[model samples]
Target: MTVGGDGGPSSPEAGPDLDAVRYLLVGYSADLLVDLDGFLPERSVAVVETPDVIEARGVRGQIGAVRCLAAVLAAPIQDEANAVRLVGLVPRPPRIGAVVPASDYGVVAAATLAAAWGLPGAGPDAAPVFRDKAELRRTAGGAGIAQPEWRLVTGPAEVAAFRAGGDGTCVLKPTNRQASVGVQILPPDADVFTAWALTAGAEEQMFRPGDAGGSRYLAERLLRGPEVSAEVLVRDGRTVFFNTTAKDVQPGRHPVETGHVVSGPVTEEVAAALATGMRALVEATKFGSGVLHGEWIVVDGVPHLVECAARLPGDYIVELIAMAYDWSLLHGFLAVLEGRAADPAPPVARGAAIRYLSAAPGTVDAVDGVEQARAVPGVCDVLVRVAPGDTVEPVTSSWKRPGHVIATAPDAPSAARAAEQARAALTIATHPGAGR
Candidate 1:
């Protein structure tokens, strides 16, 4: 971590007061930590992450009083044994009031640690279900939630069989991967072998070095409709807060998210259906107090399951939710994780949206108009991750998208327009050549 802090006493024996309320974050997330600092400014935080993540995404200097512990918690597959071993690495802080995962790969480990330490979390049983899509499908199906036809495929033959029965259009994805990695939609005439090769070969090895679920894959019949996600906060198996976020994805073989608008305009019926599906999902997972990012495809006003995550939503959705609702979602999340009651419902105070920045595949020559984009009316923030001399690859996944602009207005449409206008103000000039 670039940001330095007191590596709290080498061992628990040498630590400070035993009654201090310290939080254990199971992965390295600068944004999460910053929010934690704002929510509970006085509380101490201890983070457990692999050396690579800390090195790649350095910690910011603003988050006060953080302790960094470099440890190996990610593995080829996640299980209770690995989780237990990870817990043993913690230096036994006095009172760990809550255990939260800062990343998708850390969900199971964080839940297991929380259970072992008797802290508030999603609970051990439900965490694994949240990570594995196949298990989630079975659990959600048993709960009578609507979902597309899906099957576990061992190879191309199984995929072919699945397509043979249906219209031949199917979606293939890894059971356990984040950032839309290894997710692809195959049309009827698509080559099954080539698609399988691409899906199986995709991996987010930077933070999660190996296949978290041992190369498990799911093939599902494609559901045609708009995609939206519910940002839900649950306490003791009951949902206390819910907000629907409308999303847009790049049109191609890969379903990479390109934009998101929180509390966007939707029919009352569609909103109710999404709420119902989210409630059923919470009940099925038996998830305890925490945040759930559940996604669905609305087909004829019915919400069909896409997948869900047990941690905070990515793509700046949390920030947008806070801006739209005029409340800190991170604060509510921490409160719930600490076994406290969160506001049963928070009204939307405004509209917020985020639009990602992209460029053609080539080498970046220069990035211009970032300042002008930031100055656009209603544009809250604008960031460009690419710079001169950097390579700009095709937008195959969320990570490949360069950066984004976040905007807010009195309503969803206005906010979305503002985001787009701000995005249009900037230009990422690239050389006409294949990216490295």
Candidate 2:
């Protein structure tokens, strides 16, 4: 998930090209794929995906310099078998010097592929601990890392048992899913049977051919306090926090992250607490290297682990971090990918924020304010998802976000205000319709 665009041609920190390193990125989508023109030499990256998909994401247009190897990547998350198949597709000569997963789903595959190629990052051994929430809790608990009380619940009976033990309310999350896809907070009086039955056929957490409908849920105590995510750069088991972002979310059944503000003002006390917990998490998981997007909730001033991803944070966090720090995070990621040290020092201070646009489930009728949002002061970018005819659904995960506005200012409050104003200026008209 090392960045491509900022390193493509603009930034002075793009550094000397690492053309000698033939890196293989096992990916799920081309949506955020960057043109690694300046980071890596042309024709050096071979992306495994279908031709149409490559075109659909503007991959050919955005990252046409990289090679696109047509193949059907069916699963969002892949197992070792998928990794093996992806490895077989690589021609023997060039020899991939590094392996990177383009998304969370591709992490296990990247690790497995790296192990096969004798690359630097964590191998298949670290996959399960990072991929499965249940496994993650077990490992962290074994290491005495503080976490919300949790248990792997396979059925209604187990859910009942878990509730009877402690808090009547619990949060249920898919073991392998990201973006809080199947994360739901069950109330004390909610029907466990209905909850289990409704989530029984959920397939977004699918890995291999089997285990699709098995116990994909992990029930845990609903931790209080503000939610935040740490964007850390880890190299050879050493980790550094680049930025901590405050999240604005609606965790009503389906967790929907609405906005983010770069948290620059951290009390030294809270900082130490977060560092201790995050460091313990890194050690417990044995995440040898690469970028980690760690989610945490600070309850009663103590940070508890939510989840950590062995990849970059989605939703333009990398880009936002760069705007805030005025430092090349993507370059740091690239350095780490090559098993080298990265200067994560902040050279400048600023704030960047992103606010997502949510729409009611309906059909897009008329839309306005794209140009207006972009014109707002500090507004860096404005993305609109719905069109005149496209059906817009209530946001589930980040999939249904109507659009988002990114802005930056000298400080966090200003930046957040800019984002809010920018998003508010936009207008979306819709009619009631079926969810997408």
Candidate 3:
């Protein structure tokens, strides 16, 4: 599958020299803060984060390692307006080179600040295009792109109208949230009150104020087919394909992604269609320079855009691509951003998969088989997130996962099998009614 643009020359004027440019990573996740060292040049990157996230997210140890740090109004998504303003408040803010949003929430802030500085990034114009689902549909739909039938709903009456005459199985979710936080597949008998309740209180606002959860939602017709994600890098309107991920999400009220397989089982035809749709999407949004994590579904040999983010994909997909390609997507992204020579083509066609470990809802008493899982053939790492005395709840979203295992093999099947074996090897003990 090829995702090529008009074959224009590299935009040498995209940004300043890599060494001369200072990167502003806008968010606070311990993993993201630490990993920036690999994608970015050390001593050239700074951060703007909320004070509480710095403490609650367990990034305290990273404070000394960062090049520089500043506090904003609140969490990245919680107070986006103030977060953008905080950039100018930082010392030597004018010297900032490029703005890199660490997550979806910081996208708007990155765009806002980047526009003010005239730096290389997704500008303020494209923020709403990617941040709001309704905007995505409007732009992509106007560009003659195919997508699932969706109805924008602000309350129960709209939900009722969409459900009364439509199929019972549909995906309804918040217009602004991610990680499947408020997404639910309503049962046929479910009513508008259920929809409101599902979308309203499902968010962890993190001290947000004033429409932080958003006032709109969408009810999308469920399309059944294999779902895949394409990571695209856009520079000066010239787009190129990065990689594809095969996703597996359970069909339920709260569908959580079970695992992912990189460069997994996708037909050549479908791949080509996905690449084309992704290029169209990038063009539609006017995303000049940035990495897009776009999801799509293949129906009857045609690719329909599902959703996308103006940032990189999370859940170790970057690491998985690195393992398969023997290259860092970050560096490739940097090359694209700076208009330098870079190739995202996979050097070796290998498969990589990651599986999460979870158990029945209860209070964690004992965990077993971490080492055993790690010892599995082709398994790379096993990370456990819970310990004894930590209460566990029924997983409703990807954030609730306790641990995960990553593995690689010659093919997707073998990789998936290895990942499953590794996760199956682990054992977590818990007691019922112990979770709060």
Candidate 4:
């Protein structure tokens, strides 16, 4: 079975006769639903839906298998309710598996479902540290690990006070958000009060969906150095599977990732620093099962913790890593989920880099040279998530990326150079729009 996101069907074999695997897709939309029926193996493809109206349309003879989508934790509570209600309609269904993130809502749903279904999950108190950045910082710090110096500011007045001192350089980030969605870097000479409003106030406005806003936030001093990420699989008090990669942040942003490259070649010193820091985070959080993707910065040879994510890394990061190292992280994750052990294959190369295709700051009119860029040597695949006429917003959050260019090579410099050449080879044309 294959899971598909916006780019397209992750697996090419959507046919009905693919009796080898059972695919559980998160949500199937345009990329999988359109003009895909003929290609589907008659015995392999199955359609799963949680919406009753969709189910009522008749699923019996339309596909090989049909199952109600039951999610323990959906991004929104409304989605969770819909999924659970739909699952109740299915008879003699297989036992359900819950998906957990570090979000507050995700924590509650995962823990509650584990208790109800007798499944496994992290304890309630430990889950909070993953959700709350402020809590996580304190926990890691108390464990003798280094973290960015940060404070929890309850109000705009406190934000002003925190911003007033120091080199006038700090970062304001939402405690509950990821991918640097509500994070902003401060200017050295900027007005403390005004900048504070834009940084902290914007965070409140962004997360205030359904009248729930104005949550607590964190203001941390930014760390300087090259960023590194570790994808560590922990189970039964042991680091079962581990893959460390280099994180490429946005040019001017603090920790907002534009893309990633795996198989990072680090000296013995840096690698040791990373291992020590990761062990600290795992011990402090008491996370026994599942894989975690964490970020850190090598500051003057010392590694400092950025943040930790208790789920699979976002985007096609897992796919990129696989392409570079010839290791399947998705398969590894499924193995761990089933209480089996996962060991990644030996590293094939020293480095692999993924470069994002971002539109210039304006309204996108057209994109050109995609075919030409793909023809470049060493470039494996080019995925353009947005279309020519799609309005290109200025890069604010990590998801603002238009697409990605993935390449692998013998070393980091070679991979980075190839990615740059490929990025420059393509051009995006933006016309005048309402956007500035």
Q: Which has the greatest TM-score? A: 1
Could you list the CA RMSD of all candidates, in the order they appear? 3.9, 6.6, 8.1, 7.5
**How far is 304's C-alpha from truth in model 2 (Å)?**
0.8
Candidate 3 wrong stretches, greater than 4 Å: 1-21, 38-42, 50-61, 65-95, 205-213, 338-346
Give the alpha-carbon lDDT of every model: 0.79, 0.70, 0.71, 0.58
Tens digit per residue, CA lDDT, model 3, 169-255:
677888777788888877777776966886777865442323453547888887778888888777776775557788888656777
User: What tens digits encode model 4's per-residue C-alpha lDDT throughout 1-436?
Assistant: 1212111133333422223222222222222322233332332223333233123333232332221211111122213323333233322114333323323334433433333444444444455676668888999989988877789976656655666665667787787766577687776655546655655554322222432323467878878898888787765446766677777778664345766667666667888888878778878877656667778888888888888876666655676667766776655654554456776566555556788887776676777888887887778878876665577876767767777887767777677667767877888888767332
Candidate 1 wrongly placed segments (more than 4 Å): 1-21, 50-91, 343-345, 434-436
Q: What would you estimate as the lDDT of candidate 3? A: 0.71
192-280 in candidate 2: lDDT tens per residue? Answer: 88877765644443222344224468889988888888777878778755568888887576677899988645566666776676777
Model 1, range 6-45, lDDT digits (tens) per residue? Answer: 3333432333332354676777776676666654535466
Show where candidate 2 strays beyond 4 Å.
1-21, 35-39, 49-77, 81-95, 205-215
Sort order, lDDT high to low: 1, 3, 2, 4
Candidates 2 and 3: which is better by lDDT?
Answer: 3
Order the candidates by TM-score, highest first. 1, 3, 2, 4
Q: RMSD of candidate 4 to the true fold?
A: 7.5
Clashing pairs in 2: none
Residue 80 of model 2: what lDDT?
A: 43
